[model samples]
Target: MLKFDIFLSALANGLMTGAVYALIALGLTLVYGVLHIINFAHGATLTAAMFAVFVAHSVFKIDPYLAIVMLTPLFFGLGYAVQRFVINPASHGNDSNILLVTLGLSIIIENALLAGFRSDTRSIDVPYGFSVIEIGNLFLSTPKVVAFFASFVVAGLLWLLLARTDTGKAIRAVAREKTGAALSGINVDHIYAVTFGLGAACLAIAACLLMPTFLVNPRIGNAFVLVAFTIVVLGGMGSIAGALVGGLIIGVVESLSGLYFGESLGQIGIFLIFILVLLFRPTGLFGAKA
Candidate 1:
């Protein structure tokens, strides 16, 4: 039998890590739902936010958390403008073209970061980086706990915004059916911009929260982006709840695979699981039928 103690510890860590993955997948799903765009640039946007926080800490001596609060709105506006000027137009016709454009955007951002920061892995040195909380035989790192809680709070707020507010309802309407939303007097373009902006804002939030736990580098986003895509595919394309559940599921599976099968095969094992899910439930657990 599997040891209960070890399983509980692994489960805690998996859920905590999964919370971060869920945050990343949330943004991907939001963009896909509203704009029908895969947003290859989402990860790059997140890298940019991480770099922004790093700069604030290194140059201005500001707390990383405080810097995130200050920088989020700026990145949110940047996302809105990018969608309004570039992405929104391409979204209307030939989605492949839009995908290519975003791919180019991702390349541009990554290269720019390489040019500016070099190919070095950097981290924000926060005072709490070494802190942890222990309960019984279980121990939780402060940074991971914070990241997890922040993800939950952000997800909750997003849920409330979508379910309770008029703007949220408008966005939901557009996501469900753009033509019907337009017929009902919702400005489709504005809703699209808002959705993209919100998605990008979530990326910024996730980047900031995760920086203390992981090393920051231009290429780091590439790894997380792949995982995010897997989460989105497994959860059901454009399904928010699926993103949350799928992220946790993947995290636990990976943790267990690493413990039993070894780190090299862990990711491969997850991919195998993903393939099986596709073979059985092509639409994903929560995805709408294509």
Candidate 2:
């Protein structure tokens, strides 16, 4: 009975945490999907949003969740500017430039955050942040549950934005074939900016939702990037649905590994799964080879 209880507990916890993981990976997948550019700076974007939300909460007493409304637009603008000035200019050159530039950008952002935030861990305080709910033999962390729900809402809305909007159609067209999209008079470059902006905005949503659940610091990006990258590759680089499912799988496996072995072993388990996936299904769960 105790073993069964532990198993159930691990499963529940995994599902909750996995939801947020999926949200984090979603932005990464989207950017790569549309722009064909693997954004090595994605983790920096996550850290930046977390810091922005923390500052807003600290100075204005605004709810971290509420601050996402403004941060989303602000991030979108920043992303658009980045894509326009940096990524676009590099697009004309060798594809390797995108990789190197984004990698350098990530380092720059991390150091900037270290200077600004002083390497202290910061988090938002909320009334229900540490609360938990009991159902049968399971215990649910309140913040995790809330973050999970928020992730689902954002995911659904993103699906609509991609599937329904005319702008979305253009973005999809560009993703399918950039040259064809330009030939069709869709302004492929502008669509690239929009897609990058949308991806960045997704990070804001994920950061805001996570503010109550996790601590943020200059190294937080470094901490989570590995997991996020694994989830992205597991789900097939740009497939949103794949990200969601892959997150759940990774979460459960991680939880079980920690429960059975140890926390350090859990990290090894993640890589083991990642390696297996790469060997057998490099294209990923929902991704088709381009």
Candidate 3:
């Protein structure tokens, strides 16, 4: 009975953590869908957004949620400019070059952050940071619940935006085929910028929502990127729904493994699962047939 209770607790926490992972993976998958290029700098961009929100709270005493509102447009512009200037140049015939450019951008951003922030850990000091609620035999942290719900809401909103808007249709067209989209009067380059901006905005939102629950450091993004990649692959490289389900599966697996096997071994087990998924279902659970 005690072991079962423990498993239940782990499951609850796992679900919450999985929601956070899903948000991150959604951004990655969005870029992949539109550009057909992996944005390796995604984690770095998320870390930067975290730091931006942290600064807003620390320096201006803004609420973290309010900080997200303020920073969203800022990051959107940054993303637009980045895609317009830096990424678009390399986004030519060579898709591999896009990967190389993003990888280089990640390194540069990480090093810049280390230089600026000195590799120190930081966190948002929100009122509900350590608050939790107990329901019978189970415990649930307030921040984790908030993160989970917020992630779902954001993801749902994104889906609606893509499914309902004119701009979204253009983006979808570009994602389906750039040259064809351009011939059909869609500005492919503009669509690319908008897609990248939206993806960056999602990362910023995720960073802000998660700030109170996790430590922020220059390298924190690195820790989550692999998990994000795993989620992406498991879901199907560019499938939004895949990211959601994949993230939840990983979270539950990690939670159960940690509860039964031990912490270090749990991570190893998750990686093993990732490997198996890659070997067996490289197209992912929802990935379109290639």
Q: If scored against the real structure, what TM-score would every candidate get? A: 0.95, 0.95, 0.96
Runs in model 2 lying further than 4 Å from the true structure: 91-93
Write one digit per residue (lDDT tens) for candidate 1, span 156-246: 9888999999999999899878899999999988888888888888888888788777789888888888888889999998888988988
- Residue 199 shift from truth in candidate 3, angstroms: 1.2
Error of 3 at 66 (Å): 1.9
Angstrom error of the Cα, residue 266, model 2: value is 1.4
What is the per-residue lDDT of model 2 for residues 26-72, given as tens digits with 9 covering 90 to 100?
Answer: 88899889878788888998999999989898888888778889999
Clashing pairs in 3: none
Q: Candidate 1 has which clashing residue pairs, if any? A: none
Winner on TM-score between 1 and 3 is 3
Please identify model 3 stretches exceeding 4 Å from their true place: none
The lDDT values for all models are 0.86, 0.87, 0.88
Predicted structure 1, TM vs. truth:
0.95
Q: Return the top candidate by lDDT.
A: 3
lDDT of 3 by residue, 1-290 (tens): 98788989999999999998999999899999999999999989998988988899898998888877888889889998998899888767588988988899999998898999899899878898889989888889988988899989988988988899988888888888878888989988888888899888988888888888888999999878889999999999988899999988888888889988898787876798899998999999999999
Candidate 1: RMSD to truth: 1.7
